[model samples]
Target: MAHPVRSDAEVLSVASEGVYHRLVLSARDAAPRVRPGHFATLAVGGPQSAMLLRRAFSIHRADVEAGTVELVVAERGEGTRELARARPGDRLDLIAPLGTPFPLPDGPVSALLVAADYGSAPLLALGEEIKRRGGQVGFILGAATADRLYGVEQARALTQDVLVVTEDGSAGLQGLVTDPLAQAVKAIDATVVHACGPMPMLREVSAIALGLGVRCHTAVEAAMACGVGICMTCVLPVVGEDGVSRFVRSCTDGPVFDGARVRWDDIGTVPPDLEGAAAMGGQG
Candidate 1:
């Protein structure tokens, strides 16, 4: 049954990956109309060493009737490691339904969804939503090798057109995912593009989109300490309304942004010294 609205609760569940983990909670109460390509902040820690910050994760799926939300997380760092150790029946705390969602194209459209690595999570729901809205959706997935390539089967199940590319040519095309993307863009008349992956890949895709005169949207990943706007940690440079370049917090305003409006070159070209500083203690 759909869980009714309540403050975000922590839930523990066993996943197919053989890990028992904690997941941030969100339901219809917080986002009655939550759409695809949106994310939330989850607070995860134990009582003694409770961390004060939240981790941002895109919603993998939202079941309004069931009042549940899901996310696909990889065990990467200390926080994620802790989450991986959670047992069934354990509870977790979360702040959810945060940040702006990807914009739906206004007219009847052919759309392409490009995802690299774990970035594919959000696109699943986005593709489902687009299909529900009567729009055609195609997907392109890229990975380093066969082992690293996850979600191909799931993405294939969700959309009829699925293209897979790997650096090692382990499974699909012999080249990078962008190769297939470039080909697909040329072969079809896609009206809009939605992509989430490594910055370098997105930059190239954005350039292609610009040349084609098609609208594109991208989701960016940055080092973020606080998932809310208060921390000012996940800042990216963007051009404001007046044409003056300024910084915007990715945790709040985005994680998703219009491809044409982003200062991609600046983001791709951070100075070595500044990059070092940010890696140490500076805000991105």
Candidate 2:
């Protein structure tokens, strides 16, 4: 497990991405321990407001030396709209550096990074780390359209090997990122596949990796009223070492998990075989 930090920091900058924005902040306490899959809960409406729930975001990038953090946020709701409009000096409260990070490879090896739309937030840090260990990286970025694509250029710059895919044919390949994933993996002989995005995309990525006998790790996304473990709102069905299937909190236990271990086929609803599962409706 990684350490976490709670602090009130100043917004450093905001970069526009059509209706989306990349929100960056200066947080001395959070930047140090933050990892690739870690996330933060932000107080969106400020200190006093009817919108009491804090919004959760993946830690896009953090600099311990510079005391800063970045979040790639979409302006889809009131909370995110507020964050998008945040200025250079506005104070924002953040509980951060949460969750375990992607495991670093033992030695140099080729890798593939898969992302969906804005889900590219966490991959840059991971890509940098992979490169640091003398590994090569290839990317498969997917989106609805070219306008929806996030960090394509940044990804290209870092890895020098990226393939773009969109449903509207507005980018590199006109289709799902998975369309060319298996071929890409084979071409590069990627030994590991790391992904961060929608569950459906993660599921497909995992299948591809498993078919190729490559390891897959994922940072999953779930809707949550609270970003911590108490709510039980973001539970997932995962098999433990004991070979027992049980509900686990995505907020605490993982936003990241071994892709092969996740019960992907039964994700949207509860597992009927689980104990006491039927009493409460859809979960895990």
Q: What residue runs in model 1 are displaced by over 4 Å at the alpha carbon?
A: 1-8, 17-28, 31-33, 268-284
Score candidate 1 by TM-score against the native: 0.85
Off by over 4 Å in 2: 275-284
lDDT per residue (tens digit) for residues 42-85 in model 1:
66685566676666777777778766777766687777777666
RMSD per candidate (Å) reads: 5.2, 2.1
Weakest 10 consecutive residues of candidate 1 by summed lDDT:
1-10
- Model 1 alpha-carbon miss at residue 167, Å: 1.3
Write one digit per residue (lDDT tens) for candidate 2, span 94-162: 888776678888779898999989888899888988898899999899899888888888898887789
Candidate number achieving the greatest TM-score relative to the actual structure: 2
